[model samples]
Target: MAMLDVKNTKLYISYGIVGCGNMSQAFFGRLFKDNKNKQRRVIMTYTPSNTRAHELADSIGGTSVKNLKYLNHTEVICLCFKPQQLKRFLTDAREIDFSGKTIVSILAGVDLKTLKEYFPNSPIIRLMPSMPVENGQGISLISHTDDVSKKVLDELELLSSKHSMVIKLEEKLFDKLTLVTSSGPAFVYYLFASFAKSLEEAGIRKDNSKEIIHKLFLGALSMIKNDKRDVEDLIADVCSFKGVTAAGIEELGRQNVSESILGAIDKGVERSRELQSEVRSDLPNLQ
Candidate 1:
């Protein structure tokens, strides 16, 4: 209840995080690192076995609680566990009261419908945040149930937008967007690694290859960001007829690398749909 208090100029929030996984840490860490204007009072943390909870709480300056009862007075309760863990947590926390609490979820493939069944009295928000959130440059997809109050939605948006580019999307498109934005970063990293390996094989030192290749990406990204020209035009500007870059482009074309990357994205989207179905199936059985 006492989330923000007047103290000179800074405000604070009372946060109670439920899980302490990588994605959870990414979000909370970014919020902690970027929120210079507001102080975050991490009230408590809960994790099975209590090891990670204690570790994360200590790292983030919070207390690790043994039970959900301590979350009663917290302003925000972040559910940062796997989708399948929802039922177990609900069952274990059945004795605790959750009325009027705002629940923020970062579980992939978990829908608002399933969350409503588990937390009928609490306002639920589902968000898919990428790893770059740790640097305050992530793309996050947000969805909420209709019962959420305007004030709560505004507050959540403000908090999320501070650390990432927040987009309000239909829940039906969450899986598809997750494939493109959330999983896309890993795919891009793999592509960068492949390019770095090619450089290494070409007699470049591994460290130098990595450094140069990463800077190449940064340069290309800067060009793309600054220019409004079509990507094909941008490519044309870089590749002269029969030049080294052109030769590389011709080699990629010969290997159908462009089509292959598109195929990979399609496969990723299909897998995302499969995972969504699996989570939904698990939910119906839980009810």
Candidate 2:
């Protein structure tokens, strides 16, 4: 399996991308660059309307075209389109024969059952990925139908897991996991920004305050990722014997900020749930 090889997956005029968006760029740009994975040739062309997608082709050893005509019957395809645009793209793409192709999708809110409707015969997969694939900083949860080729799944896991964390999950579970990982980064960044803003309001030197906060976060995350300790244990380590960190945390709790953040995360999870239904179309604009 390509995942096990890690260093090399065969390159081919195979593996097509239906939409070349931010998430696609992040994942491929990270995976294909692994010196070992470079052996695999993946030739992909973007749909015509995505004018800006060409910038990624050369980097991924792919191509840019005006339509889906470049797709072959035996190719592997990844769908990176917006939820609102999913129907139209699938409608136009239906004319193509996807007999031997495997379809992987990153469209949020939509389920595998809905995706199967478009490419019923093809092996269908649903994946939830974060935008950090650009830097290989996050994880993607994947769910595929029973009939999917093990070889294709292995190749994909090799590419995807290298750059982003991979979790082989059930289709129904991604709705919530998408909220945890898909939207979690932005939420964490928002919290950091809020703290920065508060420090600024307190008349701290902007540069010094920003650096302090940024490093505090970066260092904390580094520990969490490397230490293998539970987050609560880490917090306990920092808040030793009524330390300043503990006092600050107490103040935050008194102000109800933690409750607010919990509420916000809840809203984020619910919004992700709403996204799967066609009735929630136009969500990007809903904001």
Candidate 3:
């Protein structure tokens, strides 16, 4: 692969990923999946173990660098490491000069303020991407500091828009959006598993139950997306007076399942805030 000329304004933005975890792999893997004939985007991946870094780099046709200093050439540095590891990572990486580069962080609880303290000269962008990006179907919520240039923002949007719906919002709303978009996939999987398990208990084969539930969800979501009627109206369509579906709906209401789901979301949002506070408390005082 040709070395990217960072000085070139027309070339695709080069990315240096500091952590090669699942999310990073999935996100970048999908990004580079269709670049067979085109110039592969320059991506420098690094991790302490170097195992995942090499794996991701190989899969994406990018380079796996040995350490942080090697990433200085890239225009964008994506911090995909764990939130709790930020302080330590910064300490170990103190020698690298990050001036003028864009710091894109996907850390769950680490906010932009803390990132600004670490990379004072670099523009920071906080992005929250859900798991579905692995399959090129995902939602990403982004918040950036005022210092970020429109060109860089446009480049990021161009890269991510192909695989995910990118929504730009204020940093203050990140935690709430994280609950719905970031943590939402797991919650949805839990519901799917619960329904599948119930089917298993009712004597359906486990594999068949899972497939059935998967298709069921896809069909329901398709209707919700395409149908003009309100969701309640669609529910009404499924539920005839004193019918089997109506009986199930009645039981769900009686059991407060809807309320329970709302409460769970509330708890998730609370936990997100608490995690943010904890990560903030761990940051050392800025010199």
Rank the candidate models, highest TM-score first.
3, 1, 2
1 or 2, greater by lDDT: 1
- Two-way TM-score contest, 2 vs 3, winner: 3
TM-score for predicted model 2 compared with the true structure: 0.83
lDDT scores for all predictions? 0.79, 0.74, 0.85
**Best of the candidates, TM-score:** 3
Off by over 4 Å in 2: 1-13, 34-40, 203-208, 225-229, 240-244, 255-259, 279-287
**Mind sharing the TM-score for model 3?**
0.93
TM-score of each: 0.86, 0.83, 0.93
Q: What's model 2's overall lDDT?
A: 0.74
Ranking 1 against 3 by TM-score, winner: 3
Clash count, candidate 1? 0
- Runs in model 1 deviating more than 4 A are 1-13, 34-42, 283-287
Using lDDT as the measure, name the better of candidate 1 and candidate 3: 3
Arrange candidates, best lDDT first: 3, 1, 2
lDDT at 258, model 3: 94
